[model samples]
Target: MKMSEAFATTIAGVAPVILLVAAVEIGNRKEALREGYHLIGQRQRLIDELYAAPEAPTGLQLQAVAAQTDQPMQSATRDLFIALYVMSALIVGVLLLLAESLALVWLAGSQRGSHPLQAAFCLLALVIGFAWVMLAPMLGLVVAVADDAVVVISGVSRLRRFYRDLDTHDRQQQAADGEQT
Candidate 1:
């Protein structure tokens, strides 16, 4: 293969590796988000318990409760999102490199005499360009979808836990009432 062809092929190989990295990264991120979301939800529940009594907690007590409950959740969210952002950036970098390399090959071939093969190379370059252009926006959309999904999943999970706790409390209260009667 010609130098340009060889370089383009190498670049093409890189594209797949980049895609694999992106997939793995996204999957890892999703798992982390799920774990973090559940953990934070658990913390929020603990804080809610502090407010369960008829008497309101004092301001100092509330502040202490917030400090204890919010730290781990905040840490988890920050770490997960940072990882996602970095991986998404890597996906964009690889896509751009692949497209540019192909475009370079097309440019080199055009400098020589035009042939039927040139059209094929040109088409390949166009496709690469389109893919590169689309990758960033598509990744953004994926991240947005994932974010919304995590939020909804966590909310529903928290609600389920809340209702279950409420049911248990009610049952216990009824049992005590029956014993007294």
Candidate 2:
């Protein structure tokens, strides 16, 4: 695939997908925690009423309250939960970027004399693509486009270097054959 196409796919998989998932999960967690805290508050009120009256509550109901009294409450601050959600989303996005890029490469179709260093090129491309994906919104459209273009430009240079190396190897082989002759 063309470098732009590959890079675009990487950006797509990372940016939109991760942002969407993270927002949804963070919202869900925040709502759930709010409800849990509400329950805890109601439990405290129930215990206060029981102490004030000491009658009218069933034995089983008191036992149930006692059972839950010492239960550990696990909760995180909003900052902590948001941080975790964003981090988790990033990890998944990185994996998705790798998968999408690899699929793009496979679909690009192999050519005869493709460089041995093609895998290396892909690795570097991914690094740049990832940087662009993460920073694009902050960097503005023009800068992001340049950043994206770098991946494609570097791939071109790599192709040229690979062919140059092949040319040098061919000439050396020819010279060695002449010497033998």
Candidate 3:
């Protein structure tokens, strides 16, 4: 049965309480979604730049290049774009998992009175769980997004810093070369 959002009083007025709790839960989840969307949008330009950059150098060359903060530039901006895209794709699986989970939850909820919760002794028991039919993806998404973001962000930050340092070094070298000649 599709419970009306009209607000019912059930389990000794617990329905309203459930509704209250549900509303709060939903709001909290919406906040999380906001944060997720924010996270998704914040680095868009950088991500696009990254998407266009070269594939990140691998193995010993990677370490050598990365450690060469004081060295002259080897890779071009084109290289950064290639590297960025490749690095960005490293987390593609995580985003795919998010998309799949959302689609599954949405589909399952749309089914006619299907019991999606199969686990025994679920937290929050019945009412809260019922309220969370739509929110099933929230906690999981936040967790997934948060966990993967750190490594990706740090890696990209390093790459960006490296790019800037080398670019600066190349420019200075060019100027010095021009002066010496």
Candidate 4:
């Protein structure tokens, strides 16, 4: 087989794998988001319970609640974010590989053909492939980074709220003890 044919075949073969991996990554991320949202709901419920009564909960109780709810939220968010990043990287890599393969194919085909029109077609394919490879990552990176930033910000906000609630309870307990004395 000619080098052009081999290169085209390789790109075609790899494209399916890229598509499959992207699909799986998207599914995993969706599931993680669902679980994370569930955990967020649980955490809200715990907060509501804490606020309903004046009595402060013990440190152990707070820790237990955090373990039950916060940990899972953190884990799911982290896993999903990492998976998304990896998926983006893989897509970028695949695009680059395809570009290289197309370039090779174009060069090989140009050398094999005598007709100017045939050579032009190969060159056009090469240019298109290169442009796509160069552009895809720029777009993908912007999207991935934006998503990661949003998740990180939301996670930090949740943690801050949790700790703030714990602090308020501790201060109330201190005030009550002083009144008793």
In model 2, the Cα lDDT at residue 48 comes to 83
State which candidate has the highest TM-score.
1
- In order of listing, the candidates' clash counts read 0, 0, 12, 0
Looking at candidate 3, what is the lDDT of residue 128? 41
Q: How well is each residue in 100-156 modelled by candidate 1, as lDDT tens digits?
A: 565456555646433345335544544554564456446656665776677789889
**Quick one: RMSD of model 3?**
16.1
1-181: candidate 2 lDDT, tens digit per residue: 3444455445445545544554565565566556656756766877887777746778987887777653312222332443444465566556555645554665465543333354445545455545544553333334435555766798899999999999999999999999999
- What's the lDDT of the predicted structure labeled candidate 1? 0.62
lDDT (C-alpha, whole model) for all candidates: 0.62, 0.55, 0.43, 0.60
Better of 2 and 4 by lDDT: 4
Model 4: CA > 4 A from native? 1-3, 48-64, 73-181
* Model 1 alpha-carbon miss at residue 86, Å: 6.2
Off by over 4 Å in 1: 1-3, 45-55, 59-64, 67-77, 80-181
Please give each candidate's TM-score: 0.39, 0.28, 0.29, 0.36
State the TM-score for model 2.
0.28
Model 2, position 176, has a per-residue lDDT of 100
TM-score of predicted structure 4: 0.36
Off-target runs (Cα >4 Å) in candidate 2 are 1-5, 48-181
The candidate, 1 or 4, that scores higher on TM-score is 1
